[model samples]
Target: MRMLRQLLYRLIISLRTFRKKGLRAGFAELGRTISRIFYQRAEFIVIARALLEQIPPAASKQGLVIRRATTREEIASLSPIADMIDMARFHKMFDHGSFAFIAFQNDQPVGYCWVSEEVDRNVTRVQPPLHPGDACVHDLFVSPAHRGRRIGRALVSHRLRFLREHGYKRALAVVRRDNVPALKVDKKTGYTNIGEMSHTRILFWDSFRYNIPDA
Candidate 1:
């Protein structure tokens, strides 16, 4: 009976290890063979959370560090997708008048936020012209797993303060109405909902789309 029990246990373990016999198993074997390789499939999410936390304490009272992103490479280095268009746009638009902030923990990039001096065409056409010091929160993307920890709020607040210090009177953060998390950050960070626009406005985004060659 003891022999039978031991055999059953081995069978169960073998099934767990090899029953599927697929690509995942092959990768697992590779991982085992290369014991020193560190694989983190969820690395993007971990970094996103870290980015949100690096906002200064004066912005939302969170204890996170904030620093200016010094170069286009620095900005691209922390991007999740690292697209050339995004990098070029950053280089073209970002300045002391407009700033970029990165969040880090233990020297690893976790999140990124930037303000732009450029104004949206629709917003400018419909509303009073934004003051020269006024800036817009262009993009805030954190990894999905690292959300709900107030990192967004901290980043925005820090940005607002930075803009104010640079003599900007107001800060603008355009959020999609359906984007619940972004809208939540808007409310929590004291960004007033001043207006709305149709999604048709996204037509301008065509210029930024990637042109993939036919397969």
Candidate 2:
């Protein structure tokens, strides 16, 4: 009787352990499957407008106001605070770079875009150096609720004109293949593709290489 009881206890414990392991494994696989499905396609349209004469509202039809960001505070207003590293680093870049354009509606910042320039330099080695005369589009974002009304396009168009006036021969922006909206925007904007899609293995606190795909 004693022997039977001991065996029964061990069997119960073994069964519980097996069940727990199976649950964990299933969840892990489910997470991977979900990620795979999400990344399988592009997301977001990156439209380019000629120039915004007015600020577009989140709901009611209102004009969008677009202009160059002259101060860190101005840039901060446009930033979504999605990542502190991006915010801090861009502030630093603003000091070093030339133009940082921002868009607003009713005096409230709606979107922002910037271009980094190296006029005479042959190339910039960022992890893997970018070619000389290539002006990189640093930041481009429209508020989640305020997108689809050409706000992003206007900001980008304004920046492009600024870059052209400043003598930038070409512009470059790295987009994740999964960003469908951005891809569409680029296509409509007359910005051609140039490849340099190598991942930087280095990680930093609050550093985001690209925006996560919106579901």
Candidate 3:
């Protein structure tokens, strides 16, 4: 029943996207949404501050400069690379005390990530709320032109170091279970599986969420 409902929802969304953005963009978006719903589940991972090893030499040699985004203007600058809606959300996250990092390659923004000591209610609502010393890393993205160069790994390493320096004891990251590349990167960077989460929405109305222990 749930699977059928999800398929129906995807159909509706794809039709809507097709109407708004044309066939190619619509199908692309639909493919991504359906892939996540059917093939991916969310996994929560934890990495202790003390266990965060040094950033790899490859990451260091990439000549990427990373810095925290501090103002609306800085957040707005991400528009060239990020969707406007996403930049707006990041601005809101900044207002809520979340730390945002931007990575630059030769003076152009190539990637970014966000870290927060508390969950953004606008985002996912985690059960067993975040502890005082826990930091959540979210919205990690690297430009397609710069991928496969260890840029994502470098972003995670830099965030871990930032959290450690700021007195956070552990860092938390959530990734889709079937995202082999992301999962491999997380494990290579020392994140350990801690739990799994799932969400179900009905008719754009009431929603249900489940948090399960990691086996």
Q: Which lDDT value does model 2 have at 6?
A: 30
Worst 10 residues of 3 by lDDT: 40-49
Q: Write candidate 2's Cα lDDT for 1-215 as tens digits.
A: 32234334444444554577786665664554444332433222222222223323223236787778787777677555334435645666766764577777778777777666642121222321235555667457777777888877777666776766666656666566576676666666675543334333221212223332310
Show the colliding residue pairs in model 3.
Answer: none
RMSD per candidate (Å) reads 16.9, 15.0, 6.0
Question: How many residue pairs in model 3 have overlapping backbones?
Answer: 0
Q: Which prediction has more favorable lDDT, 1 or 3?
A: 3
Top-scoring candidate (lDDT): 3
Model 1 misplacement above 4 A: 1-63, 80-88, 95-98, 120-129, 199-215
Question: Model 2 compared with the native: what TM-score?
Answer: 0.58
For TM-score, candidate 2 versus 3, the one ahead is 3
**Candidate 2 lDDT:** 0.54
* Candidate lDDT values, in order: 0.51, 0.54, 0.68
Deviation from native of the Cα of residue 69 in model 3, angstroms: 0.9
Order by lDDT, highest first: 3, 2, 1
